[model samples]
Target chain A: MQRLFAIIGDPVKQARSPDVFNALAAERGVDAIMLSLHVGAEDFAGVLDGLSGVRNFEGAVVTIPHKRAAFLQCGSHGRAAEAAGVANVVRKTGDGLHGDLFDGFGMVNALRRAGVEPDGRSTLVVGAGGAGVAVAFALAEAGAAPIQVRDRDTDRCRQLVHQLTQSGYPACEFADDFQGLRLVVNCTPLGLDPADPLPVAPERLDPDCVVADAVMAGRATRLTAAASARGHAVVPGEEMLAGQMPAIWSFFGLPGETDISAAKR
Target chain B: MQRLFAIIGDPVKQARSPDVFNALAAERGVDAIMLSLHVGAEDFAGVLDGLSGVRNFEGAVVTIPHKRAAFLQCGSHGRAAEAAGVANVVRKTGDGLHGDLFDGFGMVNALRRAGVEPDGRSTLVVGAGGAGVAVAFALAEAGAAPIQVRDRDTDRCRQLVHQLTQSGYPACEFADDFQGLRLVVNCTPLGLDPADPLPVAPERLDPDCVVADAVMAGRATRLTAAASARGHAVVPGEEMLAGQMPAIWSFFGLPGETDISAAKR
Candidate 1:
């Protein structure tokens, strides 16, 4: 029997997920298919109920807006989802829906693939939103030491630092400055627009640091470009996107096998 | 900003929706993305509620197991969705999820493109499920007369007849035989398997009849193959799929604006 699958979200036009998963499915020789679905905030409840009763479909990935909403829907969630209060993947089980957040793993995978070790490293993260929380958790999960969390919302920083420490990340502190860090990550939407200001000044960045930005739309962010000029190894958002697929595939009970180099070719 | 979308279903991996919609989105110069989401039956309600709050996604396409569920989830349904008791498209409205069934339009569009006029024409449809309901409605919408509906479950046929008549169709009746019909449509899954029996006896099919099957997976069913041998004009499931895209796009408020053909190339 053929297995069916779909992604649910509104404004579903800009996602690269179809190309990404379709290619992976074809390579795996699974008789499964994926599609784009549009659902608005008001109708999300009905659509979710409608989808579960449908016989053929097997899996789904929850995107923004829905991620936090999904955290409450699933019967249970992973630790990351609990801490971050968002879920990016929901797996269908015989009993109920099982949800887990993979955004943090995506970042970890990206950094590992780039030969950057967060363990025994001092890292600074910008932004305290969903992406920032995931990135901080990932850095902690990978054994980053003495992590500093920063955000325009100082309260958010304090809250995240508390959560990070509780989650067993190394000693955490609140810092508004970018100094003496082996790595830096920007998770806010600040760099998405061309006119957006730099999350951090270039002069404060360590030339030997590895800089990463969670913003994905265009070529390079002002932050990453400046980091590149400083001779720092920079990781692109696409790298994180590519890195996340394997773990996501695994979470969905898929084969979870993908060769990033081969895919790029 | 790039738009995001998802197809919500259980067996999401098997859907071809992502390929079709993403291709169209690319051709239309719309910065949109689509993905497949898999949610289970039990968690449908929670998941739907969660999705409604997502900020980036605009719309989604609903499929099997979810169509009827989607119908109930809609804050409001169009005349078509209300009549069919199902929905294939759910768009986010300012108020809530607004649903409309496009399968009927797809059937009508396919027939019109193939130069098959249903007005005052005699047609026999061999299924009473969702696809059959849509086709029956489309035939009525096309002004067909004396449309015959048949299903293995006699009650379903009677109920569908009642539904169709109430929805303003012209004289729908139940017929078990395929004799003296100008057009024959197999809306059931009977002919999907290559080894399955023809939905109707070939000898009973008119030589000049229009035969159409909603199956797209493999070669033509025995009925269509035999009908073709006898010089009948055959409509494949692909035609219905192609026919539906324009209307589906239109439902998303994209309409003829999406360049589907160019994207596929």
Candidate 2:
């Protein structure tokens, strides 16, 4: 039977997950497809209830406002989801639905793929929403020190820093400035609209500093472009998204790249 | 945004709606795909409730055990659905979900397409299940008279005949035998398994009696094969399913054949 998976969020039209996941599934000859399901926050629980009844519904990728709600719904959680208090991916297990956070993993993976090690790096994480908190936790887990968190909502930013401190991550604090940070990751939505300003002043960063944006625009985000022009290495959000696919595919029990490669040989 | 549609049934792996609907949707360049959702009878209402919360879920093709349940859940019904007391297709309307029966329409449409008109023809419909009732009502609406309905369950068979007669379809009665029928349609699961006996003996029908089977076995059913070998016109279940696509597509507000043709030019 062809298994059903969905990326659930409100205003889901711009989601690239269906295209990305479907293409990978097709390439691997898996009998599955990921769909973009536009569902409001109010209807999240009800929709999950309905989807649970479908035996062929293997899993779903939760996005945006639904991530935290999905985390709450799961019977169990991965370490990353537990740390971030949110879930971006869910799989139906024998016992029940298992939720996990991949946003932080994706960000860290993207950085590693771009040849920037997070260990001992001074990191500044902008935005304290689900994605920002996830990135902060993952960076801390990857040995990034003195992680400075920033968000327009001061309370949310302080809460994230406090959570990181309580979790025993060293030197977690609110960002006072962009000074001396070796890695600056923007988890804000600033780059989504063309008219939106860059999340940080790239000029203030050291020329060797690496910049990453979580905004998944079709092209380069303003922050990434500005940082790149200044000769700093930049990671676009798409790479982070790509980094998450293998884990997501495996979570749903679909064949991964290695399996496909071996089968071909 | 890509729309989500589903064919919901118990034991749904055998269903061909996903293939057929997905192919047509692709041919028309519609951003929609139909998936097979396996939900047992007990979970039908819960699943429907969940699906209703999906903003992008335009409709569903309900099959087998869920047909009557779907009818009961619909806010309103088309004439055919009301007559059959079941729904095989449902669409989301501004008010709520509206359901309709297309099995009867599909059977009649297939017959007409195969150059065997049901108008004023004496028809014997086997199996008083959801598909059988739908086909019988459709045939009656298309001017097939003296409709003879039969099923192993005598009570269900008598109920369909009574309903048809009460709905003002003339000469509706329970079948005693295959005698002198101009059209014979098998709506039972008899042909699905090759070991099962034919719903009716082909030798008992008149030489020119048109035969149709609602069983959608991949290959020709024994009844259709036998009737065809004996020089009778035959309509397979696939043709009936094909006949329903245009109406189903239209019901979901997707572009129809004419629109595709026009686009091609």
Candidate 3:
């Protein structure tokens, strides 16, 4: 039987997960399909409960408002999600549901795919949402030190920093100091629209810092474009999505699927 | 977002509903996918409840043991399913789930497509299983008076006759008499397996009577092959499936899809 995979989120029509996943599956003969399940936030848990009846429903990728709620449904969590207290992936194991966060790991993998590592690097993340926390957790795991987080939601920023500190990483507050940073990541939706401001002042980014943005669709966010113009290495969100698929596919036990970045199908 | 449709049954993998439905959807540029959901009879209710979580789920096509059980979940029943007390199609409408059965209607349509009409014909349906009952009901509705039904299970045979009689159809029990019959249909699993016996004795069939088998996997079952070898016209189960699609697509509110039999997609 063909397996069913779902990406559940409110307003999920914009998510490119299904586009890339389905293309990769078809190109590689995976006999699988990924659907963007635009479930309302209020119905997230009820929907999960109901999905138990779908015998071929292998797993679901969680996003946005449901990230935290979906995590509660998982019986186990990967260390990355455990540290971040957020999940981007959920798998159905024989025993039960297992949750993991891939956004952070994918970012690190994207960096490696781009020929860089987080060892001894100073990093700044501008968002305390699920993606921001995942990036911070992954950076810590990759040996980044003194990670800084900022968000318009001050409480969320403080909460993320506290979560990072509890996870035993050398963490600090973002004070707009990007001069000597080796990496600068934007986890917010600051550059999603044409009129939106960049998450940070692109002019302040150090020429050596590798700039990355998690908001995809636009491909080159203002921050990345400006950083690229200034000769700084830039990582696009699309690359991160591709990088995450290897881990996500492994979670689905379909690891042979070719990388979407390489397949481009 | 792409809509989700499911075919629910224990042995659902072999059903060609997904193949034709998905093909029609793709051919017409409709954003939809039909999945084969293998659910045990025990879990049928649970699965239907769970499917409620799928916000994009439009409805499901039911087969075999679960058809009657599924109709119970429908808030309303279309006239055909109501008359037959069974549903092969369940659709999500603004009012709620609406159940309908197309097997009978499809049989009549298939006969018409094959250049034969059930009007005023003497019909005998072998096997009083779901398919058998459906064909008998359709024959009755098409004005085949004194419709005959036979089954290995006498209770079921009696039950279907009673149901048809209650629906104001001229129905009776099969007395192993096929003389002068214009139509003979095999609706049971007989001739499904190579070792299984033919549903009816070909020697007893009138060479001028039209024969049909509702089991399609083998397309030409022993019953159909024998009837054809004996110089009788044969209608394969594929026609029944094709005839059913028009009603199914209309139930899904996608009536513009050309007949899949004509499209052969």
Candidate 4:
């Protein structure tokens, strides 16, 4: 029987998760289809209740306003989600719904694929929001040393650093200088608009640094574009999306890592 | 934005509505998809309540064990559904969910396509199930006189005749003979299994009659095969299914009749 999967969020019309997964499923001849559902916060509980009746319904990618709410709905969360306090992917388990935080793992996976080892490297993570927090935790968990967590919001930044320190991860204070940092990531929404200033100035970074942007653009973000021009190995947002799918497919109970690029054929 | 349509029933795995409508939707470049959902009896009420929260859900084809249950869910029924007290299709209108019966319309529409008229013709309709009753009502509405409705369950059969007669139709007693009847229809489950008897023996039918079997077969049912062998103009079950699509597409708020065969290419 064909199984149904969905991406649930308020502004789901813009989501390409369906296209991404559907292309892979069709290529692999898997009996599955994923669709985007524009479910608002107000309708979240009811939608979950209704999905109980949808026997073939597998689960969903919870985004935006529903990520935290999805975590609350699940029976349990994976270590990353429990630590980060949010869920980006949700799946139906034999007992009930299960959730996991994949942003951190996805970014690490993307970097690792590009031949960058996160361990024992000094890093500057720019953002105190969900993605930034996940990135910092992943970097810390991967044995990176002296990880700096920065954000425009001081309270959120303090909270993230505090959480990492309390959890015995290698999170630390921000270094005022970024002259020789091995890794730098823009987890903030700064890269979405070309007019916005770069999360970190191009002149201040090491030319040998590995830079990544969480926000997707039509092409490379201003930060990534500048980083690439400076002769640094820059990872675009698309790579992060691709890296995320393997983890998502596992949560969805499909057999291991999917090569989404090759699956397009 | 993409719209979602579904077929709701307990035993819906065999339903071809998704295949039929999805083909047309893709052919016309309509931003719509039709999927089958298996909603069981115990979960019916909750499913309806929950669907109200499904923002992209447009409509559904309500099938077996749920048709009459669907009538109860509708805010109002169209003429045919009201007359038959059941609905095979439901659409989301601005005000609420509205329903209509298409089985009767489908039969009349099918016969008309084949250049056969039901008005002023004597017809024998087999079975007293929902489909049979709807067919009889449709025939009566189309001006078929002295309609004979028969079934093994006499009370249910008598009840159908009473409803038609009380509602000002020309329905009458079922006759034991079919020698001069202009049209003969089998709306029963008899033709599905080869071992089951035909609704009406082929030996009693007039050689000039137009015979139709509502139950589908891999090719032709024994009754249709026999009728064709005897030189009677036999309408296969496929035509009835085709005839139903116009009504279903209309209910789903799409434009005009769908040529399902051409859509496959």
Q: TM-score each candidate.
A: 0.63, 0.86, 0.83, 0.80
Docking class of 4: medium
Per-candidate DockQ values are: 0.16, 0.82, 0.56, 0.60
Clashing pairs in 4: none
Runs of candidate 3 exceeding 4 Å displacement: A111-121, A143-145, A151-169, A176-178, A188-211, A215-239, A255-265, B113-116, B127-133, B143-146, B151-169, B188-204, B207-210, B215-238, B255-265
Judging by TM-score against the true structure, name the best candidate. 2
Which run of 10 residues does model 1 chain A get worst, by summed lDDT? A256-265
lDDT by residue for model 2 (B32-134), tens: 8888899999999899889998998999988767989999999999988887788989988888889998888778878887889899898999999889888
lDDT of 4 at B254: 84
Top of the candidates by lDDT: 2
Q: What lDDT, from 0 to 1, does candidate 4 have? A: 0.79
Q: Which ten residues in a row have the lowest lDDT in candidate 4 chain B?
A: B256-265
Largest DockQ belongs to which candidate?
A: 2
Give the clashing residue pairs of candidate 2, or none.
Answer: none
Model 2 lDDT tens row, A1-265: 8889998987566777777788787877888988889899999988988898899898998876788899999999988898778898998888878999888888887888888999999999999988998899889999999899888898998899888889899755555666788999999878888899988989999988899988877688889989999999999887776667777888778866533222111
Q: Which portions of model 4 miss their true places by more than 4 Å?
A: A112-121, A126-133, A151-159, A162-168, A173-239, A255-265, B111-121, B127-130, B151-169, B176-241, B255-265
- List, residue by residue over A58-78, the lDDT tens digit for candidate 3: 898887668888788889998
Interface RMSD score of each model: 7.2, 0.5, 1.8, 1.2
TM-score of 4: 0.80
Which of candidates 2 and 3 is the stronger one according to TM-score?
Answer: 2
Error of 2 at A63 (Å): 0.5
